[model samples]
Target chain A: MTIITILDLLGTFVFAISGSLVARNREFDIFGALVVAFATALGGGTIRDLLIGVAPVGWMLDAKYLVAVIAGVGVAAFFSTILLKLRKTLFLFDTIGIGIFTLIGIQKALAQGLSPGVALMMGIVSAVFGGVVRDILCNEVPLIFRKEIYATACLAGGTIYLVGIHLGVNNTVAMVACMLLIIGIRLISVMKKIALPKI
Target chain B: MTIITILDLLGTFVFAISGSLVARNREFDIFGALVVAFATALGGGTIRDLLIGVAPVGWMLDAKYLVAVIAGVGVAAFFSTILLKLRKTLFLFDTIGIGIFTLIGIQKALAQGLSPGVALMMGIVSAVFGGVVRDILCNEVPLIFRKEIYATACLAGGTIYLVGIHLGVNNTVAMVACMLLIIGIRLISVMKKIALPKI
Candidate 1:
């Protein structure tokens, strides 16, 4: 597999794991956890595809991705009990997943020739929409609104990526820079307990 | 308002009311109910707009629609006790709202130059996605999946709309025909306790 494809797959797996972990934390059953995991892993891309008038969403088109998510769900189900013992590690993985997804989303939208604003929005959607949906399905307020920093980090990553592209940076380097930017911002945001103004 | 605008407003109002009533049924607090009501009222159109790549979303572009939904939520909040007593009438109103939304979705998709298959999917989404979302937020399996022939009836209406459009029927006549088709099919489906096969 190409480097980009491998990275994409890695991102998907991490995202799926994050989703499954969240469901597990919520005490959902095995099937329910898998459903939430799959949705959280794929919901953003599905929405993006639908919005862009694309058919046969990415996961639908690529069976391997679907398999990866299913496998992720299975692994999570098996390890859920042990994994619950490592909350900090799971939080790290979830943040890393967000970082990876933001970059991938921006790249995909740019590949489609969308404007930077739209691409940024797509990135935020890709990184956070699934979580919002997962929360909604779990009958809770979305973390993006309540948690604050999650989507803001995506916006920051997308902005950095856009700037890197404008400066003619190499694709791989640009992606790395933006991913780190998201990770750093999210880490800092959480550590400092930063929050947006409540209306 | 223009004829088209008035029709759209009526559809939005009824849709919002259906959403509010469902929120009430779920015993959501006022804030939660408003969120549910707003989502139920406009979720379908927002999704339709996003899928068809319509900019800004229709409700976002027109503040009146937002105001109407807020008004509907207010009405529901103020008369929660009285409105809760009229459960059967609320069901009928919900059915009517679904019919109106199905027509609007199909028409808008056709206007956007989509094919019949896509338009039909859009119509089903418009008619049923909101309720799916509501159920998810309320922590229940969607009615379309379990309880009745909700989406199937919308599909039938979409088919009628497609046939009428292909046959060069007048717009109003075709609309009335499709609307009646949806309402009749839904009522019958509910009476007969029909449902789609679960996968």
Candidate 2:
């Protein structure tokens, strides 16, 4: 598998785990937990594909992604204490996941002939929408909609990706650089307790 | 426009009004109100179309739906008291809206070669997903997942639609009957304060 694909699967797994954790916290049933996990892992890509007219969606075409998500649910269900104790590790994985998701979303949108501006928006949407959907399902205001710089990081990275490409950077280099940028912004913002001004 | 087209727009308007009312109750700003209104009105149809691989979405293809949603937002913003007093009227419109949404969703799914069972699911998703999304955005457990028999009504109506078609009923007759069945079920369930047992 390509490095990007591996990263995508890892990201999906982390997101799914996060979703299952939230569902368990809410005391949802096993079915609800699985639903939340699946939605968290696949919702953003599904939204992106649908918006761009891709049929059947990505996970629908590959069983590996489903396996990863199911594994995530299993981890959350059976290893709650261990998982919760690894807050720093989990946060690192989550940041990397969003970074990869944003880059892939931009690439897909651009491949579909969308303008750069629209592609950037799609990238941010792909990076953040799964968490948005998960929080909404768990009856909480979405973190991105609150005083978080979460989506802002994705937006900034997407812009940088476009700029790097325009500046004659290799596609692979631009993607990697953009991913690192997103990861850095997210990590720094969380560590520094930085947030957008509340409306 | 066809009768279905007109009903679809009406459904969008009523759903938008409901969303805007919820946003107003939450004291969201005007922009928030408008965003909520649009999501509520188009969310269900958008989900259905995306699942079926319809590109650009129905609203993106037609301006009338957007106009209807905007009108609904206007009513919510400028006539809150008047609208609140018309609870019965609003309920009636909402019931009809779901009815039409269900039938149209079933038709679309069937046209795309989905099985009867999947088509039924699509129908219910189309009927209720807008409210699901609206409630989620407003940070509430969705009514359908709570005690309401809302989705049950849609499922029942969709089954009837498929059965009627199998029994050699006219297409239009089956559709109209399905719509009435949904409307009647929803209205009766509400009037009798009926609820599904809590999980």
Candidate 3:
């Protein structure tokens, strides 16, 4: 697998785990936990593919992605007994996953020939749409629009990636720079308790 | 206005009312009611448009739709005191709304030059997605995938519409006939407790 594929899997696994953890926190049944994990794993990619007229959806084309999500869920379920004791660690993993996913989303959208602006939006969407769906399914307020400068960090990272590309930087370097940008911004925001102003 | 437009508006109104009623049942505040109402009114259309690559989602482009949803919530909130007594009546309205929405969605998708099979799927999606979203927000099992023949009726209607169109039937007649088909099926299913086989 290419580096991109590996990173994508990493992001998907983290997202699935975060979703499963949340379901556990909510005291949902096993079925509910699995549903949340699957939705959180595939929701954003499905939306992206559907919007771009890609048929069959991404997860449906590959069993590996599904296996990865299921593995993530299994890990979460097995470790829930201890993970619940490390809520902060769980949050860190979720944050890192968002950063990775956002970068991958932007790259894929660019590969599809979308404009930088659109690709940037797609990246943020790819990173956060799963969580949005998860929160909605869990009947809680969506975190992206509410907290952690989540979407904004993705947006900033997307901008940096585009700028790097325009400057003729190597793709790997551009990607790493943007990924770090998202992670750094997200971490700072959390530590500083920064938030977007509600209109 | 055309019969289709009138039926679409009727569907939007009833669906929005149903959403507001559910929010009230959950004792959600006014903002929550508005959110639910808006989701019920526009959720299906938004999904359809996004999937078809239509930009500037329907409600964003048309202020009237938002106004209409707000009006729906107002009506529901006003009569909420007596809405419980009218549950059966409201259920009928909601069913009819789904029926109308299904036909419109199929027609719109076909007009966009998608395949008949995809159009049929879109119809079912349009009819049921709003309810699924509403249920998710309310933290309940989605009625579409759980109880009733909600999406199946839409599928039946879509098939009929597709066959009629393929046979060169007039579009208006085909649409009306298919809508009635959906309405009749939904009414019967609700009365008879018809359900799809559980997974």
Candidate 4:
């Protein structure tokens, strides 16, 4: 299996777990937990595909993503306490996932002939919009919009990736650099409680 | 012009007006209100088209929807008090709008070869998801989920429409009957304080 596919599945799994955790905290039933998990795992990509006018969406084209989400929900259902206790580790995974998601989104949009600026926007959307949908379904202002400097990290990473590609950088090198930058920004921002200034 | 085309534009206009009114109440700036209005006006159809894998979405193909939303926002900006005073009339338009939206959604989904049941769900989605998007953007629980018997009206109408078609009814007859049923249900439900049973 390709590295991107593996990372995508892993990201989806972690997202689903996080969503199911939230639903469980709210005392939702198993079905509700599954729905939330599915949305969190696939919502961003689905929205991205919709925006780019892609048919069947990414998950619909691959059963692995759904399997990952179901597995995540199952894990969350059985080991809520364990998962919660591993918050820091899970957070680390989530940060890395966003970086990968940004890369995937940018690549997809660029392949669809979108300009770099719009592709960067799509990258941010792909990285953070699942959480936006999750928070909206949970009836809250999205964390990325309201508090975190989350999408900013993706924007930064995506821009650099685009620039690197323009400068004739190796594809893998550019992608990895972008991912590292996002991961570093997310990690540091969380540790330092850094946030964007209010308008 | 076809009646459906006229009604569709009218529905989009009213939806945008309602969205901008909410944004105005929240004291959002002009740009924010316009964003909300656009989302409220075209969000449902965009989402429906996306799910059915239609490229460029609905409004992207037709400039009329965009014009309707812009006009709605402009009216909201200039005559807030006048529009607010006409709440009952606006609410009437909103009811009719949902009916038309449901019909549009179901028809689109059916054209895409989705099952009748799934098409009915899409119809309800089309009727109400714009408000859901609007409320989410404003950081509130969607009113349809929290308080209103709103989606139920669409459900009833969509179900009847599907059944009518199944019984070999004329297309326009089934559509008009569906819309009238939705309008009746929404108006009566508001007057009688009807609600779905709590889950």
Per-residue lDDT of candidate 2, residues A74-173 (tens digit) = 9998898898799789888888999999999999999999999999988988888888777778787776787668998999899999999989999888
Q: Per-prediction TM-score, please?
A: 0.58, 0.61, 0.60, 0.62
Q: Arrange candidates by TM-score, highest first: which order? A: 4, 2, 3, 1
Q: Which predicted model would earn the best TM-score?
A: 4
B56, model 4: CA deviation in Å?
1.9
What DockQ class does candidate 4 belong to? incorrect
lDDT pick, better of 2 and 3: 2
**DockQ score for model 3, please?**
0.08
Task: Give one digit per residue, the lDDT tens place, for model 3 in B75-108.
Answer: 8989776777887877777777777788877777
> Per-prediction DockQ, in order?
0.09, 0.18, 0.08, 0.17
TM-score of model 2 vs. true structure: 0.61
Find the 10 residues in a row with the least total lDDT in model 4 chain A. A26-35
Model 1 over residues B13-125: C-alpha lDDT tens digits? 66677777776665555545655776788888877888787744566445688777888877776776776687677667667777778888888898899998998899888
Model 1, runs deviating above 4 Å? A25-27, A81-87, B1-42, B49-106, B109-199
State which candidate has the highest DockQ.
2
DockQ, prediction 1: 0.09
A49-108 per-residue lDDT for model 3 (tens digits)? 776566445564466787778888888978766866877776776676777777777777
Kindly report which residue pairs in candidate 1 clash with one another: none
What TM-score should be assigned to candidate 4? 0.62
Native contacts recovered, each model:
0.08, 0.28, 0.08, 0.28
